[model samples]
Target: MYDFQKTQLEFIEHIKDPDNKPFKHPVESRRMDIYRDLFFNNIKGFLSSGFPVLESLYNEEQWNSLARQFFATHDCRSPYFTDISKEFVEYLSNEYELQAHDPIFMKELAHYEWMELAVSIRKQTQKWDASKTVSNVQMSQLASVVSYQFPVHQISQDYQPTEPSEAIYLVIHRDSDDKVDFTLITAMTAHLLLTIENNEQLSIDSLNTMMIESLPQLDAEQVIQGIKQIVEQMIAQEILVPYSISE
Candidate 1:
């Protein structure tokens, strides 16, 4: 007896690469071509939407060739359609073959694009009822404060750097308005956020003391006041959530 399940599996393998595999399906060739095109095109469309800039950088033929290779070789784990972008990144990071014409910052750029989507989708779990409901956590847990060697945020077709320069510091967070926003931060600001991450129970006074200790040559009072203002701005920007409202 002919096994339907085995035949279906064989049919799928052939569908992924119609030219290479012999089509064992008794179904007409025209109908099988539809299945092959439909399956691959949908995946390509999903990827194209996620990495629009990456797509733009390549010519149509080159893009289609890369898409075909990815479709044939990559085994995507994400069942959710929205997470296809994440899977694409995983593929690029692990298995993408670098071409001579491809930008050296391709991986960094892909990650930057993915980071924006990831931040937008991430939700805040802290419960706050106008100063009553208890929730305290580190900034690292609630936000993405990152530093990259490449100036990824500045990359475009018009401006592609061949070599690395100064570090790029960024804070990406979802605001009270439920929209994702990106801001450039100084190295000092990056240090402050990292310190808060390492010391989860940091208060304004403690942060000021640490700042003063680090920059001993500077006047303590001026440093403390400046640190306070920076922290206030961080709070206002929703980059850092304060444990105590008054603090």
Candidate 2:
């Protein structure tokens, strides 16, 4: 390899893991120290802001140690700072082994927090049509339906759960006002949203048929009524938006 490329690799290694990878290139120690601190601090700050609840559960020393480990270990795919939270969520989900002090809900909570950031920043291509009927609909681009074994939305320093609760479902969405919020939803609502998301477009009658097929024990008329109410509520929240088959 060329000398410049080798030096660049060494520089990055030292920045990521200053404790072990010595900066072998003849750079001054003070300058190398500044680079290392600046890079690590940027990552740490993003993580703290992205997962405030997760950060709150840890002491300063523990949080820094966790952030440092992620910095040294994870290979982030995106180059943008806004993407760091997503990378951190991926790291927690796939790479990092849970330490004793790490909360069991760490992965779920991190993902929940990341979803809020993601929904807030997502670009919406389709304009909302208030005049469209609720018969035809699609899941909003700015919304997501997620389920977790723990109540990640309720997790905090004072309310940490040691044992997993019943599976909880949530619909996190960015509204027309560009405000991000989450609504705790029943499993049926989550299922309906996911079905709409996967299918691209569905009508209230079609959804009722699907639900009736899945749940034969329920009366057909009652199922239809329930689905209509659900669709109307979702449309009101802008979680489900009108879509024509042609579009």
Q: Write the per-residue lDDT of candidate 1 for residues 1-247, one digit (tens) a residue.
A: 3687878767877877666777765788788779899998998898787788778788899888888888777888878888878988888899997898788888877887888888878767754324543233247334688777778888877778888778889887778777777789998888878887788666667777788888889899988778777766876777777564343
Clashing pairs in 1: none
Model 1, backbone clash pairs (residues 3+ apart or across chains), number = 0
Clashes by residue pair, model 2: none
Distance from true location, Cα of 190 in model 1, Å:
1.8
Model 2: residues >4 Å from true position, as ranges?
Answer: none
Q: Write the per-residue lDDT of candidate 2 for residues 1-247, one digit (tens) a residue.
A: 6987988888888899989888876788888778999999999999998999999999999999999999998999999999999999999988899999999998999999999999999998875555656567888899999999999988887899988988899999989899999989998888878887887567767887888998789899988888888888888888988866566
For model 1, what is the alpha-carbon lDDT of residue 233? 80
lDDT of 2 at 115: 97
Candidate number achieving the greatest TM-score relative to the actual structure: 2
In model 1, what lDDT does residue 198 have?
82
* Position 41, candidate 2: lDDT: 99
